[model samples]
Target chain A: MSSFLVPFLFFSLLVSSVFSDQAAFSSHLLPRPLILEYPENSVETLQTQLRQFDADELTLQCTSWRVAGEANNLNPWKTIPDECLEYVRGYVNGKGYLVDLQRVADEAVAYAKGLQLQGDGKDVWVFDIDETLLSNLPYYKDHGYGAEVFNPVDFDMWVDKATAPALEASLKLYQQLLDMGFKIILLTGRSEAQRAVTEQNLRSAGFQSWDRLILRATEDHGKLAATYKSEKRDEMLEAGYRILGNSGDQWSDLLGWPMSTRSFKLPNPMYYIS
Target chain B: MSSFLVPFLFFSLLVSSVFSDQAAFSSHLLPRPLILEYPENSVETLQTQLRQFDADELTLQCTSWRVAGEANNLNPWKTIPDECLEYVRGYVNGKGYLVDLQRVADEAVAYAKGLQLQGDGKDVWVFDIDETLLSNLPYYKDHGYGAEVFNPVDFDMWVDKATAPALEASLKLYQQLLDMGFKIILLTGRSEAQRAVTEQNLRSAGFQSWDRLILRATEDHGKLAATYKSEKRDEMLEAGYRILGNSGDQWSDLLGWPMSTRSFKLPNPMYYIS
Candidate 1:
């Protein structure tokens, strides 16, 4: 009950700020929940604060878990732990995740700036789409903050909406990489059929253009993300592109054969793709 | 300056609980400083608390940086940030570090316990010595908790003392691995010259035996740790031993070819070794 309450509390703040669905589903589209009318010193607020403190106590452990996940220590996890919900919510909605994302973008930008790129336009930066260049938070928040089993149906529904915002930090990195004479190649686990909406979403989210946006083909289904992405990378290598820097939110997007010289992992504690 | 005061404040709490230097450099070995004798609500305590609060505020960013380091995001870092001194100190000394260690050890032990070992006793779990098994915290505390520039001269001198203690969590994992019929291989960046003291230290710290203790040989000088460790792993493969589990606090210990089927990374924010 409190979990529901807290997310609702965070939800109001987020709809106005984080998500890019303002035009599609304006704030008034969802009615105001009656529970939020409670006074400042009410029991509901007290419960939320107490629960937040409990979550705070577990944050060090959660950061450890989250870091372990980032470092690929916790392998093959399907979903984020249920108990880390508040922690994850606080992280994603609060300052932590953004700060982490900013740092990653800074590092990647720094790496890009240092590169002596060949003038041949063959230099390319590979990026994974979901949670890398675009955030699906508007979808995930409704889907347990990735604590529940993945539902491909509504997820596809969310993708079809084509309103996934460009992760601000990644947008900055993308602009910088583009300015530095590097071709942007997005290799994502998203199905090839989603290309139209994906492109629409990318353009709307401020990603003007890319050298290539490669989505998972029908034959690419059933393969591990690492395997699929690796094959794509191999193909890029054959196409005469110098894979300079790779960035992703999952190890599957970065690992496997013929990886780039440097790969930056943006923080993504939500769902594990593989 | 506040920097020196914070370390000193943490110093008192640490000597009693954190370090295992009781016999060699007992609590009495260091004289009581005048400042510590202040009243409970004294200026020192209040200032320390206020500074601690400040450190807590930066912990999320620091955790992000540290996690980025773990995930190989922040590479080639020389030392912990001076600003994150209290944060690192709290993490390393408080329940957070031990809990993280326990979780890693537990995961590795669970993986080891599940393996169907061959009757040949050829399954080996490669372990890094410093920070992976026996900790060098007793020495690191004096050296700015790794915020200060590394002084290899004094560091080697401290290692010569043979007094490092077992990381309790890793020790438990070591014992469990041995019980599960896995050969323990102590492969470390420590020099071959320190074999005697390293052995003594291991025994005193409760690591009784191992299949082999591979250290950096004189001929292996100046090689990058990743290359050197990878070469050692290759040699192990050639020797017909199955590398089942590789555990380390550094990526250099886990990355490169012929890695274990499952490797666990223990956190080490104090320093970066590329």
Candidate 2:
């Protein structure tokens, strides 16, 4: 009787270990390509299923997160989390993207030279912040959801709390252009009142050199026609800039006239346009 | 003989006064609108006369000048004297054109709000700094004749040496928008390397907030494809900004897609775009 009991106990332990291993594998598994099987005459159903699957993947990979101190919160960005960063780098590089720090710097320098050639008082370049020149990834990661939207009040606090490390390559490139004699104009959508904090951030990030830092005017009292960019361009042209180039991470930055030399796009797949 | 001499002296003084007045007027006066009169049979003559007149005006107003007090003798932004500023303002106002500063600010804010509503991570507001935000008239006045074409290298030095004073109304308005949470981006044709001095100028002028400050990439490489402002808008859009608005003194700022929320054109008659 004693021998039979020992054998049974051993078998039970083995089973438990197998189950635990399965659970772990399921929880931590990375994403994989999905396959779908559909019945005949189910085109709509299949399409819907595929879309939902894609959305699920996106949510799982891009949106799933926890704030600091939350259970299972591993600080994705900081961890460089094995597969994620590699995936990002691969994706960017695969696209023939030039995140090559030197290349970015060189591009900036070249653009500045073009502006010099234009050499008009009206010529100027406007830049967008937040991913254009600085990386706010860590901050977002720490904060957990990207859905809260950018609240200026909160943003000012966040920027003040956060320290943006210069995108070394982009920064050097910018500095080189400055040395080449281009007037640096910082046009941003940040509220005009956060000037102090914003300026502090730029300085801290080593972007202390700029000709004019123009923020959104808070005193507008009109129909809000959505043509402010064109107006600003007009103002710049009126001021005498041939406007050799303009740069930003958004389509709006490149929308207005005279066109920009080249619009460089930075990666920000975490968010979507409204 | 005495009577004749007295008359001669009076005539000489009159002639001297006329010449003196003409000289003073030339220095301070805005160019008067010229109407060409051609014989009915000579359309070609009319065209030639018009072209010559336009050329003359362009030469007088847009001529490039050697930058003063710089090692490289770089070109700096041309100075539009106070008199010129006043004249330009008058000319535009007389033509029933309003700068519409408040309207511009409001439109920009609305556009930004729209983008935020869309959940876009990108934000941008491309601006022409000089006449749009700060007044460079004083700099021009102080430097005299040799301050016409924009010289990136010299301008950087000047920005470093000079203190920027906020254009009172514009600053207040800009600050208000910043407090509302817009990302301020400054795009200029200025060289990239002068980032430091540009920041100094912005801070001194009370434009202390910004997200990204992009200058013209002025190195040996070829010029950017889009003109500065358009490229900036494209960058903004690519980054996912809905592009709230753009403000500038010229039409070039408004030439591209995803149009801004009602462009604000500042009065600038000292120069014109082709």
Candidate 3:
């Protein structure tokens, strides 16, 4: 090589080494999982249980819970009498809880409006499934019944069999938003594996008129276990919904919007932080 | 098999088929690349020529340019010239033009305050690399780069040689934020391949005081790119950033905040989108 070429080559090698090292470190810190396990229990059951317990008590108990471990103290295997589970489920699944429902609905409505087309004048709303539009109360309630630890396989099975009755007030509000020419987008954390059952449940519950139904990408295992809501939110933002408002029971769903933008939170007191 | 087993088998087969179809469809639709490309020459001398244009005009033109393939009636390739290339390089490498430096510094200060131990009050700011804390203008401008096409080899070479002077203002802002008990965070989008160079570049730029320098995970092909930001944002939020403001050039970076947050956008008039 020429004398000048030697220096160039050396610099190139240095740069290449630097590039490789940075890439390696990043991967080390942000390792992507090959499979994402969706905990079987629904947010609804957790919400109901939270209602049953005092907030201060739960917070204290949670403080003792180790956030990272093979054991999840959040869902202890303690059997609740079937009668009690059924009663709580009924109250949670039924209507007349409009105050909380309206708060969430109002948020969703506001999000939908914010996403309304700028000059097109068309309105649209995108909703996420797991902890957003519907509650997974039955699955978790079953967990309480059997007093079992959270399991992905069992959760998938439950989702297939699960009947999602809308958080009544949310349904009415969503319908109202749809009626006003706002396009309804049903985005969910449910994997492509549960797409059919999920869509079936939505249709059965009268959520069939949505403009689009997006299920989580199966290949996105790295994100499945965490941050799924944000990924879906990006898709919604990309689709240009002037999101006037968004409603979800999870903090992740509402964090992406501009300040004072409408985001309604339903009570999901059962479990905190996915 | 027994009669009961036969019915169970049939049901499983039915369910499996339904799931398979949905998975196939979703995989086909949702995994598209988010960035687009401009003509090879479009970005050629942009930095140099851009010096004559006001920041607002530069930003408007940058965002308004059609992707290479979608340029409607305009020919981006026809605009390049050798003389203007250095000028473009100057702007791409100069630190004098960023308008959001102070804003980023202010936001970082609030974030640090939130994360401090009651009286510790040390400040820190975490920033994403691509389109966030640094401008990749020269790399693309040198190659007249376009988004639809990703040339990893050439891209890597450019990144290796890339110097980020525009970021000086942002870095200075980071320093100010740090002076108020805040630390700096150098988050990036470059995969594992660019790790060493990224770190060296940061260090070279006098950004040795960062709290963390997180990088993108490479194992899952960045399927969770959107989620990565949210997860990090949540961590910051949990850390108690009082007025934790995030700065990024992409919408994905700002997706999940609950408050009316502040964010500063450094112009990337070249070509990028989440």
Candidate 4:
């Protein structure tokens, strides 16, 4: 063999061996399923048991229990069951909850930067009022979170006080949005009657210079929260405002047509709304 | 400043400018929402219309329309409404649909490789019949997809003929699994009465050896497809089989406990079963 051909032949031999080894490995590499084990009991029995402790049913049950505290001989915050307490405590006090919001905000900021748009008045951001911008910790702290009934009468009294603190993560995001030249619009399920206190509470909590504040009128109260929120978004679209961003704690606030360009969800496992 | 410090000072200045630029960018970034536009009508009115054309109702409506063809003075296949035909056509004939399946399969194969397990007899893979392993294109070609009614009698006749072609992608994956020493198990929603033809059809479609072929019994006909499939998986777990992988055309076949180590889904927008 020629001297140059010998080196070439040796390289080919090494390459063939490597190729054969890979082929053998792939042929022997049986793929495994992503396995997850079942609970100790049969699924049917477990499902039946699950039906008894339904999350929605328990939450509703607790809501009614708290609402009718004196009527049912229940204590103010004492009636919250042990099971729900852990979840509620974690939401109110957990560092992880705040961290989650911060991470989403960080990603959302990055995404916003990439979009780079001309700031016409039509370029807008929609924010859900209660938990999205302002913290409801004070009320939930005193009244019990999901453990007590949600009383509109008592809640309205709290709302009027206009003292709920700003949700720090959302507040930071709000300032960033304003700097981005996006018009800010606040949409809330709060009644038209509470608009003044809502405005005061928001302004006091460090939210400033929003373009619009929409609240449901007396006639709109009969509508489902999802239906009502969806209609408001539709109404905004009809008015020729392009909702670029929407942040809410509820899925209903985000779903439906003429949706915003993107949505950011803040954690609110404390309660679920239809 | 010393000459040595000049370069370091210049580098620090450059780094600070980049850091400041990022900070300024983040401060002005406004995240957009995931937007979808409405058809011409208002969302509320559209939602109301959707309630009337509910999925179950539409499928049932089309089924009745197809079965009673000619008897009801409707033309064969021509009776299928334009809207339903459009959806069915988009699903089956669309390049996007096939591309989606291929993408999912690639991911599933990668996931399966990572799971690396002993190829013991206990290590098994479960696959749904019909849309997962074999194509019903031959049947659907005549039956008008979901645009026409599904007739069990006619479908059974087609099955007995055993001419349905193998779904090439899934077949390739199946061969790979077998080569890797994983035992293949076929769990189909097809009834036990059709077992003989099902076996013949699978074999003819290039599916070599599988460890088991489970079909629904006559008694299981009353059970919901999901319930029946879940129970069958439970039975396998009880028998000490470790389901490492599952591929199905429907969510029902993949859900319920003792979940496979990994699951691959192939698109089947043709119809939905409860």
Candidate 5:
């Protein structure tokens, strides 16, 4: 090799080594990933608070929960202050809430049409008694609009009087469901002792017929509200009932296994049940 | 009571009876509250799905989460498809996202300045690692933008590369915290084994110093992300660290106990861990 070529080759080698070393050096400077043991003191465990929403905000939230079938109980929201009760009333009585319900009901009705209601005693419709079929406006008005703690003694006395009125919108849907040959089944959280008054209330409220009115037995008191309702629906399914549609105010009423083909939710921000 | 005459008394008796009967009748027609036993099948307990939001909507949702510390996770959001990742990018890289961060940081700085930074070593600021201070954009660029299931192996390799860049805004805020004599503590969900790499990464990425860097332990693998993170913060509080401020990408990082006086959330629609 020529002397000039040897010098050039050595210079090129030097530059290449320097460039590679610089690249490696920079890479080495980068932070490596760390694996840490869970700190012993790190588990003080904070209690996460439920996100808060003001009354006006809650109207949209509750509406969303209702339509989605994961509604809170009929009771007032815990985070919302007492001053917001009037706003809750505004939402329940307002056109927007009603329109949304009508839309959901309309969708359920359309879905029911697709089912073959041959009346093999197989096509069943599940209905929640409170808020779904009956209106408790008078009771809540006299009470604290669901903000007050429930008094079973007072409420049962009201039930004993048995003068509850039918929810007008739900009544129309009920009659339509029956006319379409869907056997109606009523599931309620009311105690079994209230059966006589409840049955009387339903009849007087214009619910002319229903295949079954299932009430909670004394033994089922300790279970979750969702658990009891789900059992009844499951029993019906086991007995060869195909629940074409279900409607309720609380999510616990509608969610669970063996779900109906479609579920409709009505606006009820008055309470929540787990 | 019988002053008016026997006949008048008889009329009054009749009127009273009629009124009582009418009251009873009216009561029956009023809406009755139903008591439903919880459903049995209802316990098939579905994991509640997160609500959906479009790309434009997510920008707002993320902004809200950042400011308000309430956010929905990415899964089960039907509207956010894989293709709309560009929107996520737009929000994270855009002026709006940065502007919001700057606003939050400015508030924190103003807040910190007011605080008595007495160097008691108790006045400390907590920070979360990923997304809070460093941008994992390069890794997530190749991986699903938080839409796909997490593969630890792939993620670990990325961490090993230690190529993450410091989030410029966060770095600035971090320096401000240090300048104010606030002890800097980093708490992250990354495993303990990756400490060296992580430390190097932080330094290379422009984090000059911090008092402590905490990572999760192997035993904490199964614990809830929120629970684990919260416990850690609680410990810090017990040890005399007054957490004046905090910032993180996920709600888990901000929500735990011994909460900082204020928390700033960074936009991360990329994923959610609770």
Candidate 6:
């Protein structure tokens, strides 16, 4: 071998050991190239990889934006930042997303298990629909994972198909709650007009049944999600259904007066609602 | 060379390329080996590495515990779970914490910049001291990043040192807010007796002055942070100050009635106040 090649080969020998170890040690939080989206060129790929490795300013900023929303520190946000599309894409499609989802589910179940139910059959678990029970990832998979401005018309078109799948972690939680004898209430911002398809989608997705699948009425239009959900929760209260727990992706679904006894907010780094 | 060595050598060639590109791409969120703690045995290291690699259940659960606290989903948590010591260590000592801190600071600044100031100088910004402005991380660093249950006597001894450093991002934000003509209020759960040391520490940490440093009086003892802070905020209003913005590391510091126009919560995965 050439003199220069000797040291180069020695260095190569060292790094291969590290690579061999990663396979055994890879955590789901680590990025996996599971998406079959057409690959970008080497330059773009290298730049993106380097950016993530360095934990660049913009990457942290984007993460902060998403996390801030989750923490309810940042409210009334519109779309994910234009620069953070790929970050959001990788996050939503990656194992990190599942880890977050499963984490909330585990905690929620633990919380449920600890409850000494009054057993009046009025104990209800409130869940938001989209991104809580059913996922619209099939639609979002094409829509830039919320980098694009939300198009309600296009989203409604996707909803019309009623093909969204259950969030696997949430599905398990839903079933577990049912077995625990808590009544289920699906309080969603989805319009009442979508009730037929939404119900069809819910049943097909293994949700089985809910005592009440509350959706927005015509009068509920133009109200903020927080305001609308608050009113619905009030009605649930008046109906003698004790809201023992509430689960949703948006803080709006979790907050407001007459809140749940415990609220489990699952991860949704994609988008925000008021 | 032996035939077996030939394939192994070729594999090494491919792996080294991945490591070289990592330096450029390192983000603040990536784990960094900054702490000088001695390394564990290879077997233990490998076991941990493997667990994190699969995004194993326990790792995700611990992350959930921490994230749930940030989301206010988990309340009144006691300490970092025994199973998640290393995860908490890695996160607190790693780049992720700084990324979280800097992100909050940046967003807080953005929000501050947009305010149409009344120019009354009575518009005050309320700040939680520990973990919000001054970082007690040096203490927590030795305390297993909260794996150990909190020891008030030990913690108080550390606080009495009056040597805690300013969170760099918060320090910058403080300077900028002062420059922008906003009155500063330092509200903390620290006691009235510790005022001397607290003020000294604040000055030493680049916090020059505050319109008010509202620490707990003897009568304020036994009240929860939310209650105490709320009452104090009411006092601020009574004293003719407009709380334009509030920032903290705990929800207790942000919640309660008479909230600020905007509340900025910095990240604190190590502990939860309420």
Please list the C-alpha lDDT of all candidates, in the order they appear: 0.79, 0.47, 0.47, 0.63, 0.63, 0.77
lDDT of 4 at B185: 87
TM-scores, all candidates, are 0.80, 0.34, 0.36, 0.40, 0.42, 0.79
Better of 3 and 6 by lDDT: 6
Lowest-lDDT window of 10 residues in candidate 3 chain B? Answer: B66-75
lDDT winner, 1 or 5: 1
TM-score of chain A of each: 0.80, 0.57, 0.57, 0.69, 0.71, 0.80
> Per-prediction DockQ scores?
0.17, 0.01, 0.02, 0.02, 0.01, 0.19
Which prediction has more favorable TM-score, 1 or 2?
1
Model 2 regions lying over 4 Å from their true place: A1-106, A111-122, A145-152, A220-226, A272-274, B1-274
Report residue A192 deviation for candidate 3 (angstroms): 1.0
Put down candidate 2 lDDT per residue, A178-262, tens digits, no spaces. Answer: 6656677776666677678788888898997898887768653231212455566677767776665565544445454545555
Q: Give the C-alpha miss distance for residue A4 in model 4, angstroms.
A: 56
- State candidate 4's TM-score: 0.40
How do the residues B205-232 of candidate 5 rate in per-residue lDDT, one tens digit apiece? 9998999999888887788777888888
* Candidate with the greatest TM-score versus the true structure: 1
Off by over 4 Å in 5: A1-80, B1-274
lDDT of 6 by residue, A84-143 (tens): 776677667765577778878888998999998888989999999999999999999988
Tens digit per residue, CA lDDT, model 4, B1-274:
1112223323333333334444443333224210122333335533533442343234333322221221111211323465556445543564434544564565556666666677568888899998888888778877777667678899888888988888777888888888877888899889998898998889898997898999999889988777888798889889988888888876567655556755555655455454
lDDT by residue (A1-274, candidate 4, tens digit) is 1111222323333333334444443333224220122233334433532442343234333322221221111111333565656445543565434655565566467656666667678888899988889888788877766577677788888898999999898899889988888889988889998898998899999998799999999889988777888898998899988888888876557655556777666655455565
Q: Assess the local accuracy of residue A51 in candidate 6 as a C-alpha lDDT between 0 and 100.
A: 44
Docking class of 1: incorrect
For candidate 1, list the clashing residue pairs, or say none.
none
Q: Write model 1 residue lDDT over B80-141, tens digit each, in one string.
A: 88877766766676666787888888788777777899959778899999999999988988
Per-residue lDDT tens digits of candidate 3, residues B1-274?
A: 1111222323333333334443333333324421122223434323322332233233222212211111111112333234333333433343312322333444445444555333344233456676555656666755653332446687778678647534665666666666665545555667766778887776676766677777766653554444676666666567765434455654445444332144443433344434
Better of 5 and 6 by DockQ: 6
Candidate 3: lDDT of A176? 79
